[model samples]
Target: MGGMIIVEEGALRIVGGLVDGRPVAIVQEADDVLFRVSGNSIEDAVAVARARLGAGGGVPSQRAPVDVPVDAAAPTPSVPPRDLRALLRAAVAAFDPLRSEGVTEGPGKDRYRKIYVAGWPALVHYEFLPSHARRHMGVELHVETEKAAAVTGILPALCAVVRDAMPGQAVVHDPNWVGGCGRLQVVFPDTATADTLARAMQQLIVLTRPRVEAALH
Candidate 1:
């Protein structure tokens, strides 16, 4: 069993097992292990721990006792640090429409990846800004199609639909965006947490998909 270390909305815990005989601490949001760190001592592990807000929501105020297993017979399974694609995967999983419709991830380079549902006119993308910290990434919905009619005719209406649904959001209609592929998207704040970003993308997908389908018909 894991014992609480940082007891708040996004919780971290020291698992019972050790890695290479070193204590391990992990940031777990429900079943998904968002991050992991290990060091010679418990304090070392905690010092380097960085995590996203857990899906579980909140944690108990009290810190539970950590029961580190005495047996060093075998090491715990190592959880590699999460990358951009992993973050996108979490965001996709948070939304039922994306998960149910089945999204595909295109080959990504550096800090960007393209994700889309089968037969959908719009594609979801996440890109990390060089000026911003790693957590401060940008998520966008691009209306990509070979037909000029879709870009010239349908994009403005789609942008209006999204802006109407998400008032106060800085939704934009960029005809020249992404080399004139054009898109309607809102960039999330740099300060937004992982959970917040995921929720924002989920909201966009739910609001935009119907209008996109309506246009296609």
Candidate 2:
């Protein structure tokens, strides 16, 4: 109300200004008041309108202060909060440019793409799966070769190496694929920092690439 306000003839029309780039509108009838505020609950919208009106004159003004106090507004987020995909992307981007390049959004919203590890035939993939409150990060190595049987045969040893290399990480050999294709996958909780995840992925590739190349040969 201190900033600006507007009033209409129908019922009790109170139009609050924009808070955080979202408009807040309040309409009061004889019994109850209805509020429409973007990104905020009805109670919050009413509180904001009342506070603004009290601060300024009872008459609504065109210019109203919509900025809520920091304490009263939504809580601030921690760095790299629960967005595993975004964190993975940042990690790949910060890795050595020569070895890895091109981090783009994947086919799905929860996936990241174009993650290239040095000496690896195919680009790596990262995806985030949410289960309840926990978030899981999936790293995949799509091993495509003419000798699909050979690649499939070495999956056990490759998985063993991956398990040893990435302690506490879950490694699986996913055989479900089209012709001449398989995947070596690793899933782990996304609790580590971006740099840590990036290093883990790079090391995983380094440990497994030789085995894959040998199988191809």
Candidate 3:
């Protein structure tokens, strides 16, 4: 017969049958020998165990019961990890608008909003300082575009929009163009500021960004 154990949400348990005259539970799922375990009640458990006994399941008997703690009390995270590597990778992957041209790179920690205009530098880094504990702060936008209009026109337009939406500071095109993997990042003073700035940018960029030409029929 199969064994029964009470478990919570994260409880790991014995999920195998007797093998080699000893109880054998797996640490994780086993490929070929998985179907052999189908026990619930005294009757069903034994039946499932026996069905796979002679088929291919070896006679090994070393089942280990795992105790996975219940996660009902643990709070789910609202924010992603601050690790720059993972953050940059995620940003690149999710840069849906840039599906075709130009690659996405780094959460390069910058003291101020760093811009890349012409060619990439050997090293480019930036930082994001969140304003969670602080009452007020500002967000600086960093960006790049194949069109010169983005540097002169688009980014300037974005600054005006942000000012209108929120009390924003000065917006200037960085004369020092430090390039890299071809993506731009705007660092906000805090999480809240970042979110708001991104939202505003998205609204404006959607309408203004050069539309992708439709495929020929």
Candidate 4:
């Protein structure tokens, strides 16, 4: 009621592509509502989604506010209470606060809104913006290469390594592909833990960056 979005579940028509910006998606069914949100933990968001989606409805008859909050300064005694997107945005701020999400251009030189943010348990291409957030932890690691296409080759391995490195406390998201570059998110459970692991990753990238640069070149 407060934060969750109530999108009438149905096979909505999605038209326009190639030249037009419309890309259709049949998210849920007609009878049930589809609750999309971003949050620190995938489980937290999913929990709320299930509850809200299960609560049948037409419209609230009242506009509700999104539940996501902001935390400019991170690493508090407790996990920052924010939705998934806000938490990712906070992580992005720690690395490059000034950088704009900017715009995206497609095959036909058509432009649209674009932001480089990490998504997990769900990809941004799937259209997810959570109403609330739990908390997140991870290292702010950025990878730069000559060709963004290079991500295609190393992403799987990188994800695996990052997962193995952080184990359960990880959610690597935000694989940016623009300006001939890409970015990665290496989330951890806490600051100290993430810092130690992030250092190791930094050392590893020193060796891996060259190969990706050379291969892409």
Write the residue-wise lDDT of candidate 1 on 1-217 in tens digits. Answer: 3322332232433332243345665654432346676765554555445322332334432454343221111122343333545555454445434343555555454545555656654443322221123223455666455453443456676666765776444444566765666665554433334565566666666766665556556
- Which pairs clash in model 2? 3-63, 3-64, 4-61, 4-62, 4-63, 4-64, 5-61, 5-62
Candidate 3 lDDT over residue span 1-217, tens digit each: 2222211112221233323223333321211123334433433444344444441254443433232122101111333324333333333334335322332333444322221212333132221223222211222333333333324334444444543443222122232343411222232322222334434335323332332111000
Ranking according to TM-score, highest score first: 2, 1, 4, 3
lDDT of 2 by residue, 65-108 (tens): 34332211221223233676676566556544524344333344
lDDT of each: 0.47, 0.49, 0.30, 0.32
Query: Stretches of candidate 2 above 4 Å error?
Result: 1-81, 97-110, 116-134, 144-147, 177-180
TM-score of each: 0.46, 0.47, 0.26, 0.34
Rank the candidate models, highest lDDT first: 2, 1, 4, 3
Off by over 4 Å in 3: 1-81, 95-155, 165-172, 178-185, 189-201, 207-217
lDDT of 4 by residue, 76-99 (tens): 333444344444344333423223
RMSD of each: 14.7, 19.4, 21.7, 15.3
- Compared with the true structure, the alpha-carbon lDDT of candidate 2 equals 0.49
Pitting candidate 2 against candidate 3, the one with the higher lDDT is 2
Scanning candidate 1 in windows of ten residues, the lowest lDDT window is: 68-77
Those runs of model 1 whose alpha carbons end farther than 4 Å from true positions after fitting are 1-98, 121-136
- Stretch of 10 with least lDDT, candidate 3: 67-76
